[model samples]
Target: MQFYCSKAAAEALETTQKGKVKSWLEAAPVPEAAGPWAWQVHAIKLARQNVFIVMERETRFAMVFWGIKKGDGETLLKQFYERMVNLLLCMNQDVNWLNAADADVAIEQILQRNKRYCFVAGVDRSVQTHINEVARFCEGEVHEIGSLLMDADEAAGFDEAMNDTLRSVRGGDYFYPNAVFFCSWARQYAGASDELCLELEARFQRVRHERMAMRVAKHSDSSIPVYEQIMAVLQGKGLKP
Candidate 1:
């Protein structure tokens, strides 16, 4: 139910025409006030463009729209309504006019004729399912690599304590431990040939460094220090940082 805007988003909201972005935030439904399937919106900005992320925690559902403009909140809201209608239709639920009659009528007419419908909730659920399956497989793979590392003569320095630390450390909170595990994993299990794994490791390092640079650039320009505050709130809620 808590709302937290990213630093870039906060800055954009502040600088945007008055009542533009504020109206969008006001229009977004609070989680506590919404239905089980309703979205909780989070604002963010990337490359000077506004973004609104909609999520439903119970279903692990999410949808994102970027590069939003002033006075476009209604457009996004209509889109969300359309998406939900399409989803309900897909599930063979009886179609009824949505509360936003004008918006729903137009969307309903469009959907009535269209045979193909892509629902955000459906897509998000599918993706999350796939991710969970892949994660389970990858965890097994990582465990194999870890075992190899522990048994190898060259891995003498990486003892049980070090391995425990690597596994337990929260990757989202600290970058260095993540980098360490990534490099080790890439080197040990990425490819059959040592040269291939080494090449993959180099590429990973380059990508990681570039992303870090970009993060620094984005966060440094914002005055509010929004990310830290948001993280603190999330941690307080017993969510991952």
Candidate 2:
């Protein structure tokens, strides 16, 4: 699927602090030489004084980095880049395995397989209008992913419950009642059955590999050990790694 940022987000990024602007200028020439998605950073330029634009050609996505002059643009770019990577990785399994040319072809195949389009928006009030307009233009559903956690007490309890369930299962203390309850819940939510769960379990490994590939691409030194161990396990299971 194509990715985009809200116009307001783009506008807000127009004039960042001086330090980041300077760094962008210095790094502009080698924009694709590094980063999480080295194949994606097509162009980085100072659109105007203190205003920088980052373009990702593969997805036709662009963002403006503006305001402030003190800190590096790492925080802003990291947040945006991670979200972009997540979307791309979720949409195409080959995102981590193939070369840029092959990866692009894989992404195209995925898009052809899934006809629906979706627009996701961050829950920032400043960009609501832009999000609405884009959603309208695409004639796609618009949704938010994270604001549900704003209910602090409910979120904390939910987290505790999930962790407790995982701990119990890991400790060989799986309770029949909880298992039945979760199975029923899954059936109601996604019509999951025993066979479907088994299928999903196998599919989970593939998804894990995709995520690991992203980590290896972005942080090879730290991610390689874990990746190697997981690959060995998958190989042991007679699965492709």
User: How do all models score by TM-score?
Assistant: 0.29, 0.23
Put down candidate 2 lDDT per residue, 1-241, tens digits, no spaces: 2223334333433344654432222212232233222111211212222322333322123333333232334555554444333334432342133355654564454334334322222233322332233223222211234222323344333322332221122245433222233233234333457876454434544655676567655755664577686676558855565
Provide the clashing-pair count of each candidate structure: 0, 11
Candidate 2 lDDT: 0.35
User: lDDT value for candidate 1?
Assistant: 0.38
* lDDT per residue as tens, model 1, 1-241: 2223333323433434554534223333344433213234445434444555544433323444445663365555565555444433321211121234543454454344333222121223432332233234334534666422223222222321122121222223422222333333233322225665454445544554454455655666566465565555446756553
Best by lDDT: 1
Q: Assess candidate 1 and give its TM-score to the true structure.
A: 0.29
Cα lDDT, all candidates: 0.38, 0.35
Q: Estimate the Cα RMSD of every predicted model relative to the unseen true structure.
A: 22.5, 18.8
Clashing pairs in 1: none
